[model samples]
Target: MTENDSSAPAPDRAPALPPVADRAAFEAELDALRVREKAHTREGDAIAAARRRLPMVEVDAGLELTGPDGPVTLLDAFEGRRQLIAYYFMWHEGHDAAGQCEGCTWVTNQVRELSFLHSRDITYAVFCQGPYEESRRYREFMGWDMRWYSALPSNNELLTGRQVGSMHIVCYVRDGDRVYETYWTTLRGVEVMDYNYALMDMTVYGRQELWEDSPSGWPQTMDAPPEHPMRTNGRPIPQWSRIEAGRSDDLTPGP
Candidate 1:
């Protein structure tokens, strides 16, 4: 058959396909899975409840971070809000935009429309591991308007025992002038910022990443190793659109 023909599988390789079933059979299978889905959702809610109850640790309110207006403290970053969600963005110092962290770009680009969090009296910001001026240019290139700051100077104190240079989400709450860290997560935990992965999980192909437990012949094009799955053509997938749209990817400070 020709490549366009869908009637038969190619002789060289078996096409990946899900087993076909009648509507009744499909509904029966779906209903069975729905029970587990509901349970998973409820368990998630319970876990969130537990997270809310977890005790917080005190962090120095005077910890310095470099913002647009120069030096600002951790307390200042909250912008007078009672709560804060800080994404500790990984950075590759001295590298151009394309050489920066792809995983960080994957999650950070998804964070738009912060009014929902602001409505709840929460502030969201990025604490980048690179210098403010250089990284701020990156933020502009990526079209991010949410607050951005350089956490490099305060990295030793802020990250402390945690691994530096890794992507992290840290939750904080303040009372008067005292700041406390309520929760923190890294690696796949940062997936909370991603809607793409969540939606892909519901699709038949499911992320197309090699790490998943997909059946034989299922397309797993997102393989990794020297490069990340979130990247395409040497840059993060999202950067391509911005570059194509004539946006500058230069991280150098403008005059």
Candidate 2:
């Protein structure tokens, strides 16, 4: 109503619009996102590369393994299965089958059915690191019929590198008469096959990782620290090889 007020520009005029985002700014933001994403993808690729470099080990391919019927070879144990996944069960004798490996048996027990593996033309077996005579009874007691063979008298065949700990997944792809070690994983990769821990964590505890998705104060069994400046080695601490030859006195019955 006042003359001065009328002269002023309409108060309702929309505020000056924000400057249009620069292409560089937009692209830079996108680039940052991509960097995070690609880092993850590249990390996976790097892992696969390291596994590929694990080196191939050649065995006699002629050694005999006592199957249900009789002696067999490393190849015969495959039985024409296109793929083979073997778990190296650690045993050094004097431990008895009951104590072969509480950890290894824990995993084997979860294997629901080999029928699925059979259908896929893949053979799943376990290789014992001890003498056949010492391990066969242990296998029997565990009630596992999965194809098992002894890796005794280690020749060139690939060794289960379990110096610190032994749970591993070794994949083999057979081509004609040759067998190749394809892909192998030791850490969370093996956890993919783990059923119990995953289920229980969700129901109550939550994944025992540091950045858990649960509310504050949740119970966590594994308290591994973050990998920033403090690297988390994860489960299965490093172990000494069979060279130690545990003392017989170590086996004394608990008082």
Candidate 3:
């Protein structure tokens, strides 16, 4: 029968499995891996310590960003907090919700709890690249409650020397009225906001993506279509749930 034929019986295939081992053998292997994992964790802590000591650059505190209450300065985004974590959300000028950046959606969707950050005097917000009203609707559709603002007018000044259209996690601190950019990271660096990836890393298949080094016969279709792994059925994977829940993805302004 043809591959697409419904009447075709499923081909008999052996399941890909790890070699069987006794409980003691498995525990011994796990114990050895724990040593490497502990070392890796310590290295991560060291890197963060170095990051904390890095010098910061002064930014135009008065740079304009459009908020729900109209235009506001970058300093205002801190909301009286000592520090701010602004996510520069990539935008498609005229794309609908389904056409938005899947990677950004994936990371942004995972940021739900802010009280933990707030307790440490840090505020988290999104500085979107699209128009305020247009992107605000998208935010509403996705049920995101984080502070949202349009950084389009101040993109050049706010993200100087950085690619403005890409996703970024910029950290800032306020000294009285002066705003200083402490640190910023993009690309995989933004994975710090993702719990899914962290959990997937613990799985036997390890994200099940093309880049992972897996045993033969392991499934690697997580990167299917090869271009957008975070997307499914022409939309970001998370957007499908919002759509199914009867939320509006229309970005157009309402009457």
Candidate 4:
């Protein structure tokens, strides 16, 4: 076929297909990978089992937080539920909602429906590391109707040895007025908060993060912001949509 023919591959770009092989051979390779995939899934199950078996630590039940209705204790966050899942949202202190932690915003946006969590006798809440007035405004700006609280006053008591401004997913069990911290995780462990990343993981591009073991010629922009998956033009990707909708992101001072 001529170089310009439809069957001919583009000259400049790398071939957009996997290594050439017969159909049967390709199936065989995929089958081999399937074996490993199954094993990986089983391993994940084992890890989860171990996590469930982890010993819990008692937390300060009397720790005070600022909620919509004013001062409340950690136990109050449970809302009479058996369990509580608190997302420790990072904040820019003086920055507007648009300048809030992009990674936090992306994950927070994933939790639109709390009925599933509520059905399991669990309550999910955002414990922002900033003032209630500014942070609650950020929550409203993002259209998040879930329970929001300012953990800034109780950060030292709630987080203990952990860094105050970092993102964390902390699980707690409420027994009457007492609260116990069952599990806490950060960084990649918080990926469970993000359904978008889970969906992206199933795609051919696979998150496009530099750390993924993608095949050669795969579309991975390595130098892009790895921490902020939905970041664009120095703002969270969703912030642009909010701005387009005429929603004001100015919750605090400055950008």
Separately for all candidates shown, the number of backbone clashes (residues 3 or more apart, or on different chains) is: 0, 4, 0, 0
Instruction: Give a tens-digit lDDT track for model 2, residues 1-255.
Output: 332221234454443333367999978877898898799889989987887677665444555555555566767767888777877666657763323454565576667688988999999887666666556665554456777776555422455444423556777767776777766666445665668766865354555456667655554334235432111222221111111233221322233
State, as a TM-score between 0 and 1, how close model 3 is to the true structure: 0.93
TM-score of each: 0.92, 0.56, 0.93, 0.88
Task: Give the per-residue lDDT of model 1 (tens digit) for 48-111.
Answer: 9999999999999999999999999999999999999999999987888898999999999999
Highest lDDT, which number?
1
Candidate 3 residue lDDT tens string, 1-255: 333332243366343788999999999999999999999999999999999999999998999999998999999999999999999999997778988889899999999999999999999999999899999999998899999999999998888999989999999999999999999999999999999889989987677677778999876654236667787667887787777777876787887
- Ranking 2 against 4 by TM-score, winner: 4
RMSD after CA superposition, every candidate: 4.7, 18.6, 4.4, 6.4
lDDT of 2 at 106: 56
The stretch of ten residues in a row with the least summed lDDT in candidate 3 is: 1-10
Tens digits of per-residue lDDT for model 4, 5-118: 222434565524567889999899889989999999999999999989999999989898999889999999999999999999998977876678888888898888899999
lDDT head-to-head 2 vs 3, winner: 3
Q: Which whole-number lDDT from 0 to 100 does residue 30 have in model 3?
A: 100
